[model samples]
Target: MGESIVITSGKGGVGKTTSTANISVALANFGKKVVAVDGDIGLRNLDIILGLENRIVYNLVDVVKKRCRTKQALIRDKKNENLFLLPASQVDDKSAVTPEDMKELCSELKEEFDFVIIDCPAGIEQGFKNALAGADSAIVITTPEVSPVRDADRVIGLLQHHEIPASLILNRLSVQMVERGDMMSREDVEDILAIKILGLVVEDQEIVNAGNLGTPAVLNQNSPAGQAYLRIAQRILGENVEIPSFEEKKGFLARLLGR
Candidate 1:
């Protein structure tokens, strides 16, 4: 059997969707069969981030409502044959699918793929509940900022209440700012959140360029964020890769992030 991981945030613009895309690709890089499920029903952008927007004819809602087969909604990645995407409906509201529906779909998906990565909508509403319902474990995405960290804490509480295991992926962390005392250190954020650090991703121009080009930063061998993602992926698959610190000679990737 496979595991389902929900990538969620309490607020927007914290790179939740981007993390989902890259993480899915990173897992696929290991030759695992992976599916990226867009759980944000209405304001879906995972498709756009994954650059599979033009190929989506059916989506999650379609499969739930029996408008199409679950197989019909899956859009296979052009580059990674093992990576697929189940897009979300742009018009349907959260009311269109319930937590029960998510659990059922996720159970079926678990049978088909090695990993099911859900991209949750921002906030603690029905969308968040639906996303959390199907997850075996969670990756709470947040930046090293006050507001996002606070919001991520709220999400973490909810996850705990549901008895789900969760870790933090501190995104867009600036080591320069942390070193200069201009931004919160990784330890500070972890102390506030009180969760295991899954991995850290530094703010990088390469990540932005990869998203713009409809590719995952993990595919790039030299990207600071890409290298960090590869390490993160290794950790997810039960590998014991060390999280590098600023003083390490491994360079920027070491100082970037981890859990």
Candidate 2:
């Protein structure tokens, strides 16, 4: 059976979905049979991020409603044979499924996959509860900003309350800003969240570019953020890996802005 992990963030727009898509792809590339479950229900975007939206014939709701079997809802990744996605329904409401249903679905998937990664929705609502219910562990994604860090703390507390182990993924960090003390440092984020750091993804334009093309940055070797995500995936697989520091060039824009 595979380990179940939930990629969650209390606050939205913290790259939770992006992390789920890329990490799942990264793991699949390593030959692990990986399945990513979109737990965001009506607001699901994991399918879009994986470029599998058009390929989704059945959704989570369909499986729960007995409209189709679990395998019917599993969409294979076009680029990776080992990767599959269980997309959430865009038309069905979030209340259509419960935590127990998610747990049962994950238990079923675990029998066939090496890893099941759930893309949890934002906030501490029913959606979030359903996502975490089936998770063996969790990856909390957050930006280095104060608000994100604060929200991450809350999420960590909730995870602890549920007796679920969790690690931190600090995303969208600007190394230039950190070097200039203009932004929170990685250490600062760790201290605030008070969790073992899983990895750090630097703010890179390549990530945005890859997303626009519906390709995960992890597939791009030249991308720094992509490399970071790959390392995170390795860590999740119980590899003793070191998180690399991203060195950014302090260009004219920084000096011109007095940063």
Candidate 3:
């Protein structure tokens, strides 16, 4: 059986969905059969990020309601046959499917793919719970901000409650801001929410451009953020890939805070 991994965030806009798309593509590049699930339901953007939005004829709700088979609902990736997208229904309400629905869906997908990545909706609502229901493991994404970190802590606790192992992905980090003391350093966020770091995605305009263009950042060989995502996928496959630091100096935060 394959693994079912859910990518979630405490709040939106922390690169959760984007990470899901890019990571799925990265795994596919490694010759793994990966399926990216748009667990966001009504507010689906995973399809847009995966650049398969226009091809979504069947969706999560359809499968839950037995309107289509799982294979029929899956849209093949434009670039890689190893990757597919199980899109969420844009017309259906977020509450239309229960946690049980997601559990069954993920269970089914994992049997056919090497990795089933569910891009969860932001926050600690029913949507979040629904996404968490079938996760064999999870990734809680956050920025370096205080609010996002706090929310990540809450999510980590919830994941712990569900007995699911969750690691952290500190996304949209700016090394320059950390050095200049204008932003929270990686240490600052880690101190608040103690968890294993899965990866660190530096802030890159290319990620935004890629999303707008319906291409995964990992597809851009020139992008540093894409390279980081490649390493993240390696780690996921049980490789001891070293995660790089975002700061020029390790103790930048300690010196700034006089700790």
CA deviation > 4 Å runs, candidate 1? 247-259
What is the per-residue lDDT of model 2 for residues 174-255, given as tens digits with 9 covering 90 to 100? 8878877789988888777789999999998998898788899999999999999999999988899998765444566876
Error of 2 at 104 (Å): 0.4
**Which pairs of residues clash in candidate 1, taking residues 3 or more apart in a chain or in different chains?**
197-259, 198-259, 199-258, 199-259, 200-257, 200-258
Query: Which prediction has the highest lDDT against the true structure?
Result: 2
What TM-score quantifies how close candidate 3 is to the native fold?
0.94
Q: Return the TM-score for candidate 2, rounded to 2 decimals.
A: 0.94
Instruction: Give the range of the ten consecutive residues with the poorest summed lDDT in model 3.
Output: 245-254
Residue 224's lDDT in candidate 3: 87
Every model's TM-score: 0.94, 0.94, 0.94
Q: lDDT for each of the candidates? A: 0.92, 0.92, 0.90
- Give me the displacement of residue 154 in model 2, in angstroms: 0.4
User: Candidate 3: which pairs clash?
Assistant: none
User: Tens digits of per-residue lDDT for model 3 on 112-184?
Assistant: 9999999999878888999999899999999999788888898999999999999999999999888777888
Candidate 1 vs 2: which has more lDDT: 2
Candidate 1 local lDDT, 140-250, one digit each (tens):
999989899999999999999999999999999888788667788788888898899989899999988898889888999889888888899899999999877753233
